[model samples]
Target chain A: MKLWLTCLLFACMPAWADAPTTPTDAATWLNRVAQATHQLTYQGVFVYQSQNIMAISHISHLIDNNGEISRLDALSGPPHAFLRIDGSVYCSFQNKPSGDIEHRPHHSFFPEVLPYPNTHLNNFYQVRSLGHAKIADHDCEGVLLIPRDAYRYGYALWADSTSHVLLRLIKLDAHGQTASQLTFTQIDIGHAPTRAQLSIDFNDKLPIKQSGNETEPKAVWQITNPPSGFHRVTETVMTLPDHAQPITHLVYSDGLATVSLFIERQTQPNTFHQQGLVQQGQMLLYTRPMGQYQVTAVGAVPLATLVLMADNLAPIERK
Target chain B: MSHLAYANKPHQTDGGHDYIALISAGFDGELDDQELLTMLDRHQSDINASCWQTWQLIGDTLRQSPSTHPSQLAQRVAEQLKHEPTVLAPKPLRAMHTRHMMSLAASVSVVALVSWSALHLALISPHTTQLASSAPASSHAIQIAQIDPARLASFVAAHRDFALSADSPDTDTSTQNTAEPTQ
Candidate 1:
């Protein structure tokens, strides 16, 4: 009788495992995540982990009446903070303006940034549906995203069933290990947030200053051979925080992905990191050296795309 | 999640495989004129989509370059044909006038032929025969620069049915023949 009970339990287990209370639909899931990032106004605490670094950050984001969004964050890494409004980023240090800031800006677009252009992604990646899983204590659905080619890596997303918020995002590397991970330890979605919660506190005693000098937009640096569809967006002469010599910050983009070209005075650490891709949540980073300073470009696109961009860096001096 | 999830997985929104294949074939010389034309047509949407960004990066290089090297008479002619912008000119007006041979030639891909012929007007160049093999088999097609380093490597890889982008791991250099030293 005990032997008979064991066999019955095994058969029931498979059926029981399949039976879940509910799972959120996948097709409508990504759109909900986009809505949470854009429409919902809330402050949340999140944890980010990578192969080389682990950091925690507090983000307070708000969408104002003009629909212009502002994000204030105090990232706990060597004590630096960012007050970013749209494209411009103001990096602050320990409750004070760091130094004479040379704003080297790249057009950073977020939240399905290039919405229309991605219809092409369907050709290369077969989007598959996985039932559901739990992430950050939220009952989340599982999504299996497969790459069509080896040029890029793939990802698995766990989105909250109730709120449609992305609770966990895992970026997979070539070896199938977790190259990067982003999980929300605490989250509040679809809740209204107050202005006091989102705004940064600056001491009234200090004078607020914008230390960047805008360059002439048409300062041309012609590339003899760039990859197809790319053009030189702009170039600026700026100084780095530790270095005295002004470096040339060149930026390039194709409406969707962005590549930065920084020609600075080369420093020690001559053993440069091989063209790499470091992911922290939605951001992807690729760094390479030009004539001098190491050119580090970061965006939401694939690392290979940026590596090719940097490798094909042909020199052009105002022609 | 099972590790296999990461092993063979990719984002559903990552769709540059066909494009990378097209570019590799285009550069590798593996794609025949018909194959090239078919790919160009089929990938019209994708080219404008994912591949176009990288293509834009490559196009910027093409636009600012006369990279067709070895000081070939063919490349000189192609360059002369490229710089005379004819895209904005109304066609009927040019057809009515006989003196605008440059504009008429610029309108047609055959401008490479005229400019090339003019370069070899006085010399018996051996490359003319080699160049004939380089032209698209069909009258209407996207012409791949058979000798350009960027195009040559890519064409060789593509024709061998391999992609040249980050996806494909190995490109055998033993297949490296027929291309003159680019530098």
Candidate 2:
């Protein structure tokens, strides 16, 4: 009887040791965040910090019968508003007329949210849960995504526990130093935004206009050898009102961060030129003469990233 | 705390270990007046003196303590003298064996004085060939030279995937392009 009792106790040991609560993994949590950011309605004031540059913006996102409508108004500095209706983006500056609307999917002004769900993000980044944190007065689960390779930087992401919306996003450099941080100071989840909050009403006296062709043309220029994982996503020819000639813009992305390359023909000899690389905030700019054209690659990626893109800039050859 | 915790069994027979522990205790200010006197007496012997130094060095290394000992300056002078040719003849001093201590002190002081003079001369005299500053002057330039604002704005405006800036509300509409289309 004593032996039988001991055997029974041993049988129940594993059950007693097992924990009842199971926290969500990083991938599932991230997927939920990507969904919540697009599907839900939220309004918040977020602060973006890049080195010494700190800008606060009030953002409101509403999903109506038509589609998603988001508005981001700069709270500090000169007043500026970036309003989006479905896929069209409109801009307004302080004391200036509203800018032309463009037909393109808007960028996530908030860092916590990414526009696309990168299914293969796990292949490049090893995601790990960093326990719990409180952000914007809400309990959040923080996750650190360390890059598997040097081609891209890492990210420290935090999602709201209840809604799974991203509450904070920190871009870490190759050396693990914080390159930039974007966090919401205050946020209201599931809040029905007023029409005024989601709308951008420009002054009647201010002139409003659109610039450039309606659609982006095929990319004439191509990166001969782009770094691993980076792919050219969008190519467009932009004709700014002030510039004499149109500039060719090519965008490359590694799932998360983006690099923008601008190519323009050197119409006249530049007497004064500041060439090489210039880093401002999280953006790194590398400009050099590419034969007859001046190529400038700008992005939040490492200097090596821009250099790689700049070295491989060439006109695409048609067979 | 465990390091400070006394050994359960004291092995007085182990001279080196006992002395090291006592020296460590003396350094930690746990030694009483009698124990401190005992430590001082042990410090006088050559073997114990060297052992005390080694133990102190180990403790300092473990604590990551910056060495501000005056002996460092003497060591530097000694090292400088190793490379330098003997200036003052030790031959005359070597004959007087009774004044050996005085002779050693005199030699050390002379080396120290010579090292001091060499340092002073290096600092006072300017070099004819000036190497460029290790840090480029432009790198440290505090004021960021402003490029053509219009040109920079145009480039930035054009390069932006989407128009993010509301600074210029003109027909600029490319800042939004920076954001990639959803998967």
Candidate 3:
């Protein structure tokens, strides 16, 4: 009688055995991250490391109730820095203006992956709270962004305890190995980020105009043909400094992904069959051919997603 | 443009590092400067030299043809042959655009490819079987030869690009067909 009672007692409390220490409340944590990035004013230095690339970016973001934002990233590689005052993006390279990049607003959900319907994410990734840890000397709550489908990589996020901002993120491949990591080394959250810090120190000096706007007339190319859910936002004609001719630039974005199309003079024959997947740190790129143009589409997305985006680039008409 | 990467670090894997893959990106104007730097960094020797040569070759080909995709070669000439507009004399000729193709794919994805391939050894398309059916390997019992789809799904999932074409006498189609028989 005693033995049977003991066995029954253990069986009745089985739920206790599988429980994790300080389980993360997934929904609450997600809401917290969304709110913090959108509502908070922050300044920090973070490193983005991927398959074969390592870049350090210093960002200062200021957000007010208006939803209008201002930011700057002192990029340590590629020898350029980016500054944004409101909607305009200023690049120190290409000697371009401190204005908008004639580039289209294709599928860029940076700072925050906006317009993202959380419903879709749930289908692809199993959100899990993986206890607590410390990142950059700050206490954090850990959550695993496990892939429910093999179409994309998974991510692990460690969000700050007090503010709930993501302090670190690890992107993993199919074998659950680290493919890339973005982690904050120093951070400060508050109402004001100094204007001095927001200003980009260009060329170790101020930016000098490269020249008069050599920007040719914007191309009227509209991709009357596009993959599903994608739309052409901008089409422009750009002059290459190294190459002698101006090229057509067409950009398209589905609410969450972007594809860049360049139509230049074809300089080679299609003798080589180069297809499949390629990687540069955390970014996966897919190369394919589209009419007359060399379509090379790269994004920090799943290889399948990039491949689909590249394959469906159709010609635009004057509609 | 720095040789420091080659100088400082050891080669991670010899045969697998794909420099041309990234440089191919440069040819299209997609790679940002940092990405270009990283590629140059990892491949400072013969690999880098070969990648530049490949770019030159591609550029020559494109300049020569300036009218089409650099990767769609003489092989797909057959597909282009089908592209020739046929006249249903006096009737309005409609262009079967890419949208139509994708719509067809989305609709059929449910009926033919993904679902039933779960069990059957071979699934062939009702309308088209463009696979050459000659990929060597599977020569065991119950040869499930998929013509286009039930075959196409696995092909799409694995390669992202595929077409179906088959000829008789070559069980190559049988062995290569990606289709699984109806469950």
Q: Supply every candidate's count of residue pairs whose N, Cα or C atoms clash at under 3 angstroms.
A: 33, 12, 36
Tens-digit lDDT track of model 1 for B61-117: 433354433234334433543464333334333233333433433344354445445
Instruction: Give candidate 2 misplaced runs (Cα > 4 Å).
Output: A1-28, A92-107, A111-113, A200-215, A269-275, B1-149, B157-183
By lDDT, the best candidate is 2
**Residue by residue across A108-180, what tens digits does model 2's lDDT show?**
4563256456666676666655667899999997777666555566677888888888888877764566767
Residue B37, model 2, lDDT: 44
* Candidate 1 lDDT tens digits, A50-125: 7555656655556667454444343553343444455444444453332222221321222212222223444434
What docking grade applies to model 1? Answer: incorrect
Scanning candidate 3 chain A in windows of ten residues, the lowest lDDT window is: A100-109
Which candidate has the highest DockQ of all?
Answer: 2
Query: What are the Cα lDDT values of the candidates?
Result: 0.43, 0.59, 0.45
The digit string of per-residue lDDT tens for model 3 on A33-122 reads 766765678777777666555666666677755454444353553333455454444445433323222121111112343222223445
Where does candidate 2 chain A have its weakest 10-residue lDDT segment? A202-211
